[model samples]
Target: MGRQSILIVEDEVIIAMELRETLEHLGYMVVGSELRGEDAVRSAGKLRPDVVLMDIHLKGEIDGIEASDRIARSYDIPVIYMTAHSDQETLSRAIRTQPYGYIIKPFNERDLYSNIEMALHKHRVKSRMDGSPEMVDSAINMIAGAMVITDPQGHIERLNLEAEQLTGYQLSDVEGAPFFTAFGVSVPGRDLLIEKLLVSSEYGAGSMISFPSTIQIRMKSGGDLLAHLSTALIQEKESLQIQNIACLIEPCAPDTEGRAGGYQGAAALVQAIPDPFACVTEDGGVLLYNDQFSSLCERLGDGISGVALPINRVLPESFIGSLAFFHEILVDNQVVTREKMVKYSTGSIVYTIRYLPVGGDTGGSSRCVALHIRDVTAETLAMHHCERAQGESQNTDAAVEGIGDLCTALKEKVLAMSTAYEQGLAFHDTAHERLAEVNRILGDIDLRLIEIEKNRWV
Candidate 1:
């Protein structure tokens, strides 16, 4: 495939040229470059680039924000804003354009690449969910949870894309199959059956039903996934008779709290995550957490069997800085992340914790925040090792040059013994200095690890 194309729109010639060079260096083809919003809009409509980098301030009658809005309304193109403007009025106007991302001026290459990649991914996902569907198939696919609709007799009628993906069976393959055959659900250490749950009495023609506990669903491929299942009886409006039963299954982790309602709806989904994660109320009460979280708590000597404990008390002192970020979530209503190197007797471990607001709204009205903790020690250590190797390679090149100089001195006939001895001493000193530098790096790493351990306990 050809390189992804980009269009640059900036009133400033220098910034536009520099941005084009950066994009080309990053392997993106710069298809069009324009200084005015009108030209940009015209070029975008004609060239149809993969993405556009637009500066909020432009030279013509319409600004970059207005141009982006026009392009989006006309061609569904994604536009990323680049600007130095930080005033509220400017920001308010830029946001209304719904740009893919906003990058502050003087941003690094990494920031630009990350924003473009994310914007492209989001655009692709949105495109996938916008295709035509028959009946309520469109609505079904839009749901985040897997759903299957069955006839009143409990025969499979329709299943959404998520359900098909989860069960490893397409809707066509399971069209006439009984709900049990298609979804093979079972409770661990219990004799519960999918048929038993579908019986009319449990979810009668009149009422809906919710699974009492977390159940393990066996996919057609023979793999098991944990989920929370709920059912609703669809009724015909005119006859008031049951039409079909809709089974909604969402990923969830098992909970000891046994709390019911909307909280459980997405609880198992959080638990299914491999990372040590927890959802806590704004006031610090634990709402839901995965088994990895419980295991981490045990390792830290924090009792986490209950539903209500301040997060500050559950994690080790290594998390004190993370706790402050959690507090900041309520203030900025934005995701806060922290990475810390931890010292253990065996070696150092690096942990990164992120506090993400539960809901999409950035308003402070969000009542809960989700905490995700991951051990990035291996990657962090690998990066350090790579840097150290590069430094050592440079030192080796310098030492090779010194050796070449010593050889040249020996090859020249009139070289003095004293001078040769001095060169040898210099070489010896250089080697010693390099060794010391390495030791210093190691010492610094160790000390940082120790400090982390000390702080963790405090």
Candidate 2:
């Protein structure tokens, strides 16, 4: 980081003097001038220079190559090999130390300066690359965060052990899947992410808004996980930002069932306890509708979910964006609470809608979000009159317990392994109906094959 110091270990006095002159001219401080390999190693230990310039073929059995390796390993010093022995055998031996740079004997001052500068540059770059793991470990490992590094094409590269363990899909299963195809959630601003990402000119064009958003994704086991995501391009090339996406899930707490999701999965239980629930996707469409949810709104159909539901049916179009509304039951993904409300509804009907993240294949582009709905319209209103509302007092407990239970349940469900896996599934209304349906569907083609018994065929 500071002005670099170089330790010169050339045995030839003239060559050593010449190299020192060249290094000094190139804005480097000559820390030590040594003739013997052992002396050079000792001097390097004392000087603790920014770098070491060692000549490979020394006078003793412990050559410059061995001395350089010791200097590097012991003192964490950067070494550049400088020697007249440019032959294949000697050069191969010198390279074992992974020296910063290699320069042949009787090199010119210009070449010498270039090598020194190159050595420093290489060390700096190496330092930068190697610093990341430690930095990442310090920040993410203890706080329960999931860090995913991806290639330019969005294939999974390296996921921390925690991320691999939580998602239920190993790195081998998910490495090269397309980001969208793997994660399944339709990215809200795919055109924008690719807008500048796939092209050279617009890579950093406008003031891009960073969404501190939470979205849901499904796991390899078909259950969903709630991931808190902050979407940004980490490493940028000319056209593409080889991204490093980070996620920190608020650990879901223990429930009445004596379970807890490691992070935010605990609160989803309380969020699911109420009736008349509907989930809205990030793209502003209805994702699901529970049975009681459909009945409350007078809409009933088997295949009513997984499609956009019009929001204008319940509240006036202009009221949707009104800022005067507030809820009593809203809780941060990291915070657990019981009685959050959606006060924006007409007639002031309060509903508890707990949000969860559903990560799909790659997990960063969360595909689906869960809305655990609980209708608290009447209780919420009655509490306004009764100063000593019991439910209101336990609002925090109910909300926390409810969401926590569901989240814990879901977390277990998401990571569960199934041995009773079956392929063909058939559903029917009644016992007779099921038999009839199966028989009709199979037609007269369904005949049992005879099992051959050994020797005793009666």
Candidate 3:
């Protein structure tokens, strides 16, 4: 918020003094001046000025350009080149440093002020673009409640840290096994109904089904929890078929509504995700989808239940074209991530898509895939605008620089013409004097010739 400080790195004592005076007159604080490139580099790293005015030809072996490079790599400070030399090789080397501005010497007050201000503005803009991290791992690990994601066929695909703590099973040991086997779930009174629902054809395809009775889940450590069970289906986008299932168990209090008709706890975990999530089969069937997915479908005018829209229909065309990349996860069983940009009538939307393969086989292919989609439109737009701002700023600086160069060239040509005109005037004055002298000599010779003729006649 205060006046910007500048570090002057010039070899010539008079020039450096003049530069310091000019900067101070322009309301910039001139920090300690350094004549040597090595000294300037050290000072820049220590003082950390807003900008550095570096002279191309420094006193020592290390030139201004080299010092600027070192400072740039370490401190990211903006450097403006001050040089009288305009040779091709020097220009090329200086350009590689990408100095904010180049001031051709015998620079005036106006040139110094404009270049320094522009460099400071550019540096500030760049600082804003480079911000802090978006997400923190410690924050995610602190969330309460167990979360379990399973493949289309009900195999335990993943268990979060909370799920591991609650289920008394490490993810590495229980992953790829059936959910019931991993957690050891048992419905004491409604065993028959649960068995039927678990093996039913509709359940395999990720149908939403819940039990009214209390369910008991036993941890591997023999600790048991009595909870109400619920299930939500994640469907594949292409086939309108189910791909995965999410099961939520809540400790049901006595006198709570046990009839499964309107109870919401079963799918509450899946619904808690802020992003659209789905589980798809290896063959592209919709197994399970969260409420966010349903909302997204409705917004896109593609009904999830009525028309069974494929994943491609829901995502942008750019994302759809990369479907093969998603399928590769099933083959290699590694997580694949992709980002897509979509333009709508309103504006552009960016989606960060992550495809995670599911199923428990060590060497075999995965049976299902889980997709977590994040709407990163806001962040993406911010980044785009930032880049565009930086570019426009650079373009503006370049235009100013071009104008300055043209002015400098014009000034040089004008000086050259003035010098030539002065020389011509001097030449003309000398020629006039010589002509008068010649006339005077000729007149005297004529007089002498006349006197000689008169003497002959007498």
Cα lDDT of candidate 1 equals: 0.67
Model 2 Cα lDDT, one tens digit per residue, 328-384: 111212212145443443545555544444422332344434444556676666556
lDDT of 3 at 218: 73
User: Least lDDT summed over 10 consecutive residues: which range in candidate 1?
Assistant: 188-197
Clashes of each: 6, 38, 22
Q: Report the candidate with higher lDDT, 2 versus 3.
A: 3
* TM-score of candidate 3 versus the correct structure, residues matched by position: 0.35
Candidate 1 TM-score, true structure as reference: 0.40
Error of 2 at 126 (Å): 2.3
Cα lDDT of candidate 2 equals 0.51
Model 3 ranges with Cα > 4 A deviation: 1-266, 306-327, 359-365, 420-458
Task: Give model 3's clash tally.
Answer: 22
User: Which candidate achieves the best lDDT against the true structure?
Assistant: 1
Q: lDDT tens string, model 3, 1-458?
A: 79898999988886788688878877889878999999999999999999999999987979998999899889998888887654656655665565666665555564576567546644554434322222211222332345566776789766657767766788688879988777767443332333443554332322323443344577778866656555544444334344555565555333232322222232343345568877666666555567787787666555476223456666544554345755777777766778877668888788887776754332335655677788988777777787977766665565555556645655554555555556788566555555555455455545545554444443
The digit string of per-residue lDDT tens for model 1 on 1-458 reads 78989999988876777788889988999998999999999999999999999998888889988999899889988888887644656655665455666665555455576557645654665545433346457656655568887887778878988898877878887787787556666432211222332453332332224443455667778766667665655444334345677677766554445552446645666666778988877677777887899987877656687676877788765563445556678567666778877676788778888776644222215556777888998778778887977766665565555555544544342234334446776666555555555455455545545554554443
TM-score of 2: 0.29
Ten contiguous residues minimizing lDDT sum, candidate 2:
447-456
